[model samples]
Every structure is written in C-alpha cells, then in structure tokens.
Target: MNRALLLHGRQYKPFKGFMEKTKQVWLVVFLFAFSGRVAAQADTMARQSAFRVFLDNDFINLRGHGSDQAYTNGIRLDYFNVLSGRRGLFSWMPRAGENSVNTTGVSAMQVMYSPEDLKKRQPDSSDFPYSGGLTASYSLHSSNPAKKFSLRSEITGGVMGPPALGEEMQRMVHRIMGFIEPKGWDYQLKTDLLINVDFTAEKMLHEFGRGAELVGGANASLGSMNNAASVYAIFRAGHINPYFNGFLAQTNAYRGSKKLFYNIIVSPRAELQIYNALVDGGLFRRWSGRDVSKANRPTLTASELNLGIDYGFALSW
Candidate 1:
C-alpha cells in the first residue's frame, strides 16, 4: 500500500503544471492509449509490469574555450506489461517475451537549460540551449536474468520547445521582487523546435559480487538536435541479480532473486562529439570571439569530448 502511494506521488510532481494546458493533457491521454513509449525497448516483453516511473539527475560537460556545465532533470513513465498477447490496443503488433526482454512502450518529458539562460538576457553572454517538451519511445533487450552478458538497446526522440511561457513567468516574478535583469537584448529559448533521435547499445562489461553489474555501451544519435554524431563509452551500475535500469526495468530472469533490493544506479559516460550544430556561444554569436559585431551564430561540427553522469532509482511491485 505504501509503495502504491509512493508511485502515485512520484508521477505527480513532474507534471504539476500540465493540467493548465489542454493540449498537453490530451497528449498525455493519447500517449497512454496508443503504441507506447521507448519505441525501441518495446520490441520484447520482459519484466512484465503494467507500469514503472523514475527520475534522473542528468548532467552534460562541455569542453573547449568557453567550457561550462549544463544540466537537466528528467522524469519518465514506462509501460512494460501494458500489452497482452493478441488481445490489446496494439493487437496487430507482435507478441514477444519468451526469448528476450520486451518493453511494450514509454512516454516521457524533460526540461533542458542552463542556469544562466534564466538570468536577464545578456547580448554579451553565451547562448545556451533551454527548453522543455514531451517524448515517446520503445526499448527492447535480450538477456537471461542474472546472466553476465546482456544486449540492451533503445531509441528516443522528442522536442523541447522555446521558453516563451517561462520567460513571462520569470519577468513577472522579478517585477514582484523589485529585481530586474539586464536589458538591451532579446533573450530567446535555446531551441525553437528540436527533434532528436538517440540510440544506445551496450553489454555487461562485468559483474560485482552479489550486488551490481557494470555495463559498457556506445551511443549515437541524429536528427535536429544540431548534433551530427555522438559516440560514447558507458559505465553503468545496477543490481547484480536483476540487472535493472531505472528507465527500463529488469527481465523475468532477474525476478525472485534472493538478493536484497537497494535501488541506485550510477551511469558515468565519456562521450566524443563528432559534430555539434550548436556550439561555443550557443545561439548568441557576438558573445564569442573578438568581433562584437559578428551577427551570425556559427554552426560547429568540430570534435570534442564530454564527461557526464546519470543517477537513477527504480521501484516496482
């Protein structure tokens, strides 16, 4: 009973502002009624739970001349056991489970931005990406519970629109506080319309003593993220027996393990950026280089390395 309440509480905090928008509410409904989330992970039917919810503290490390930190908090709702064999909303889709992990669907959303973006618009400052939007995807993996090697993969796509609403709210709050941000520049949301397709494939590099497994993987993505290509080395920590990922639950193979459940996964990643459409001063060009009159933002496709970490937690019946 306590767990049920905990799950409900977990799902509400992220979408508290959602009820104000009818479109977003409908989007939420449509996602639940249709194909599902984590479109890639849905290929198999493992860890057959009707639902799962999770939260993440996500970070991005940028390198180069104007190096600085980037961050975002992510919340996701994953539907695993939603599909029944030949008897569900996706009746035409293939029914899977026996041989691999099949996660039917997923629906999610996130807000991405830098703390500086919220400050008064500074024509002289770096233009960092800031926006929030919805997403749906699929996930699929093949593995035997507790086994050493696991093949896991997924594809995710979505948009984080500009911060028109947030900007107004910020201005209003500043007025109330008698605190005004710097003026003379038009501050805009980092990305007006962003579409991203991300992919990850990894294997169990090794296992820990009765507690956790280490996963190593490579990730690549394309689309309008302005990121032409990204390849990374992944190190993940998860339950040794269940092999659980907060976003994606464990397989039936991990079920009933005698090991006690203590939930936490630390995913440290080292990524090499092959191409980046959004670079340096971000959307603001004059903020970088010597030419204050430089009007055009440079589209960078240079190579760079990034160090990042993901903290995750999971709960299920």
Candidate 2:
C-alpha cells in the first residue's frame, strides 16, 4: 500500500503541472485573439468616420487667357460617405470584385453655356447656344483593391432652360465681378425635364514602379439630359497612392505617419456623342409662336464625335 501511494503521488504532481501549463497557454491565446478583434473593430470605425465633402466651381473667366464661350460657368457640391456594409441598396449595384469597397454620394450641380458674342441680342446661329442645366444626383462607387478596378453608377434628375436659373446665376456673377452683362438669354432652350443615368468603369493597365501607373476606362450616359459614350486612358506619375485604396483610392491612411501626396495626370479621351439636351434642345420641342425657320432658333437634334485631352496636377496632404 505504501509503494502504491508513492507511485500515485509522483504521477499526480506531473499531471497537475501539465494541466496548469495548458491553462497558461490557453490564456495567452485568448488574450491575443481578443486584442486582434479589438484592433479590427477600431479599424472599421476609422473607416466609417472618413466622410468627405467637396465644393467645386468652374468659370472660364477665372483663367486670364480663356474667354467666356462654350462652357462658361459651373458649380457643384458633393457629399460622400463610406458604406459600412453591402446589404441594402448597395447590393443592387454591380461589384468590382470580391474585395470591394463601396461609397455613396449625393451632388447638386449647375452648368451654363454661352455663345462667343455674349452682348449680341441675337447671337450668331452657328455659334454655341445659350443653355443651362441644374441637376441633383445620387451615385455609388465600388472599388476593388485586390483587382485594381473601380465602377461608378449615378442617377441624375433636374431641369434645363430658364427654370435652371442659368441666366440669373450668370448675370448675378457678372454684376458682382464687374464684367460685361449677357444679353442673349431670350433665345435659350425652352424648359424641359432632365433625367439621366451614367456608368463608368476603370481598370489598372500597368504599374510603372511605385510612383507611376496607367489606367483605362470607359463611360456611358443615357437619358433626356445627355446620351454619350467615351473611352479614356489616364497616365499618372509622381508621389501617389494606389488607385483602389480609399475615396476613389486617391488617398490612404498609413499606420504611423502622413505625408504629402501629389501627381501629374494626363488623360486622353474619345467620345461618341448621341444627343446633348443643352445644345440640341429637348427631345420634345415646345413652340413659342416664334418662326421655326429663324436662324436664331436652336435645332432639336444633333450628334458628333469628339476627341480631347486633359492634363492636370493634383496635390493633397
């Protein structure tokens, strides 16, 4: 009995130590897993808090060399927020890839066009027409970092012509800036409803080192406001972030620090324009008892092919 008790005591001591060691190992693992989960939650919170707002204006007169013709004045306000999950309205849209980040935006915009001779009561018939548009849009942007691709879709609704308040807005700006007052708004396009849907997709073509890359994309629009399709290629070089990181992937958040970001971009595009409401007038013409054969009367149908190049520099900190 004494020998048996001695043997049992020796085995029990080692067994107890083994059990204690296993508990310590499990505690360490649990702590590590808990901390990792906390970190992931924090990262998600940071991403959710990153909201953006933009106010943009385009005025031909702002540039010292450009004249107030063709596209003259425009203004847009945008609000964007990162979507937390892809369960609701986001699910209705197409995804870029498996690892896609989604963002939603709302924007209000107004654009104006003018003829070369703004002071003429009856502008030349062949010159660009006096037109304006006011539109509000809702959009969804999806980007995939793993695949280096992005997709954007938007729905816009509003009005064109006098109801857009284009003439009023332009005259107000001219008065404030002491510029020549425009006098040819009476022949502008008649009031019409504007509704449109636009879609754009882009993919990375090649990456040249860490600072330069090339991307290709295509865009199409359909509706009463505008109908067009275009394909473009963009070349960007300089200190920049990957194109699929955050908020169009133009910027990113690093682990330890922040630095200035800048890039020089050149984009060339080819477009097939089917119909332009601002220039071709509305789909259904409304007669104002004016002579239809008059030279000043705008046409209700137009289409053209265009090629253009845009180059600019961007900076952010």
Candidate 3:
C-alpha cells in the first residue's frame, strides 16, 4: 500500500505542476492583452497626431527580426496617411507633389547574427539564430496632409550577412553533391545584397454612405530577390471610428534585367495579406533563384508555401 501510494503521489505532483504552469501561462497572456489599454486610453485623447512615437516603435517591433540568414529575420515598416492636414490637394487631380511619394518618415535596421557560426550548429527551433543586415532609406513627400489622394516614393539598400556558419555548411553540401557528380566539381555560394524602390498611391472612397479608403502601390527590388513587385488595397470599415481599419495587399515577383543576362531565372512570387489595428498576417508562394554558370544553367524553385501570423498593437495619430 505504501509503494502504491508513493507512485500515486508522484503522478499527482506532475499533474499539479502542469496545472500551475498553465495558470502562469494564462496570466502572462492576459497581461499582454491588457497592457494595450494604457496606450488606447492615451490615443483616445490625442486625436491621432501625437501617436507617431508609438507607431514607430510598434513598426520596428513587428517588421524587424534578427539579422542572421539561417536564423535572423527581416522586418519592414511603412505608413501613409493623406487625410491629416492636406485638404486642398484632393481638389487637384492626376498631379501631386514630386516628394509626396518619395518620403519615408521612419527608417532603421539592425544585424543580429553571423553566417559562419550558424552552419557549425544548426538549431532545431524556428527562431532567428544567426544573421546580420543593414537597412537605409530616404522618405520624401507630404506637401499637404488633407489630400484625398497621396503619393509616396522610397529607395532602400542593405546587405544580408551569410547564414550562421553557412560557408562550412556550403562546403559540406558541395562535397556531398560533388561526390555524386562525375569528374569536376563546382560550388556556388549563397549571399544576399538588398536593394528596393517602391511607390504608393492612396485614395479615399465612400461605399453606401460609409467612409472607406483604398491603398495600392508597386515595389521593385534587385539584390534580395532579383525583381519583385507588389500592389495592395485596404478598406476602412469603421466610420467615425478611425482606430479600426482593414487592409489587404497582393504581391508579385518576376525575373529582372540582371537575370535576363545571367540566365538566372525565377518565377514570379505571389502573396496575399490582411492587416488591421490589432493584427497582421499573410500567405505567400515563391520561386527560388537559379544559378547560371559558364558551362551550365541551373534552375531553382520555391520550397515553401504557407501562412504566418504576428500579434501587436498599432497606434497612429
């Protein structure tokens, strides 16, 4: 009877421990959700002009990830508002200030890991492990704040450090692949250089007496994915309630000028996304880049197609 009692006691202890841990997890989640109340209350009083700081901070948190290619993540933050102070610009059509589409109010980036080390020990978990990068861009445009339609243009550049310990991994992979190939062996290193340019055009529209808006734009890039472009549309479902809005953007990709010459081809990428004041996430499919050499041309393809999620608060005034 004592031995049986001891076993039962041990089982009960584990069950008790699990329940305690579960309670703590719930508490953390509850706190995270409730923490936004403070920000919401402050925003209610500010009327949307003084919330730039919070918006900037949130943007960095959402889009920025560690910089390691094998483990580092990438982040991007963008904002476009045409209703603030420029009411007269909407009266004019087809033409707006040249700087309108060229401005980016907040821009910054950080590198988080080194590629050489990543290959030495491949982590099992899906977290940013080893990578580094730099991001720089210029923001232009904003002659009128109340314009119904606004335009924006931006140029960005950055370099992504190789995956954590990728060189060693590449060497191993090359060795393995070479052993299978006949006589001569060649190794191609995977590295990234980032270059991007984008334009945005936004307009306000009404649907059945409801206040709504439309956002659409195109983006082009070279270093990271060869050539990529995107267009998006967002609608405001709330009236008099500016805090709740919904937006969707569609992105496409294609081979570019450089690829034409190198025979390094890639099929276009396609993506769909939805975002609101509280949440943002998306689904995407891509075609990988090919390697074209003097002797042979290689074709690569996308290896992933899936959805991703992000949880955060956004404040813009």
Best lDDT among the predictions, by candidate number: 2
Residues 1-317 of candidate 3 have per-residue lDDT tens digits of 00000000001112112234221000001121222111111112222221221111111121222112222223334342323333442333322554232222445443232221233343322222233445666543433234445555556665544432333443343365332211111111223555655555555443335433333333433334233333434443222222112110111111122221111111122222111000000012111122223111101112112121112221112
Candidate 2: worst-modelled 10 consecutive residues by lDDT = 1-10
Instruction: For candidate 1, write residues 80-107 as lDDT tens digits.
Output: 5423234444344332234444345555
Off by over 4 Å in 1: 1-47, 50-77, 82-98, 114-117, 123-134, 141-160, 163-186, 189-193, 226-240, 244-266, 274-302, 308-317
Q: Which stretches of model 3 miss by more than 4 angstroms? A: 1-95, 98-106, 111-130, 141-147, 162-193, 205-210, 222-226, 239-317
lDDT values for all models: 0.38, 0.65, 0.28
Name the lDDT value of residue 317 in candidate 3: 22
lDDT by residue for model 2 (171-262), tens: 99778756778899998878999999999999999999887899999999999888988888989887666777645355333222345555
Give, for candidate 3, the lowest lDDT window spanning 10 residues.
Answer: 1-10
- How many clashing residue pairs appear in each of the predictions shown? 19, 0, 37
Candidate 2 overall Cα lDDT vs. reference?
Answer: 0.65
Candidate 2 lDDT at 269 equals: 72
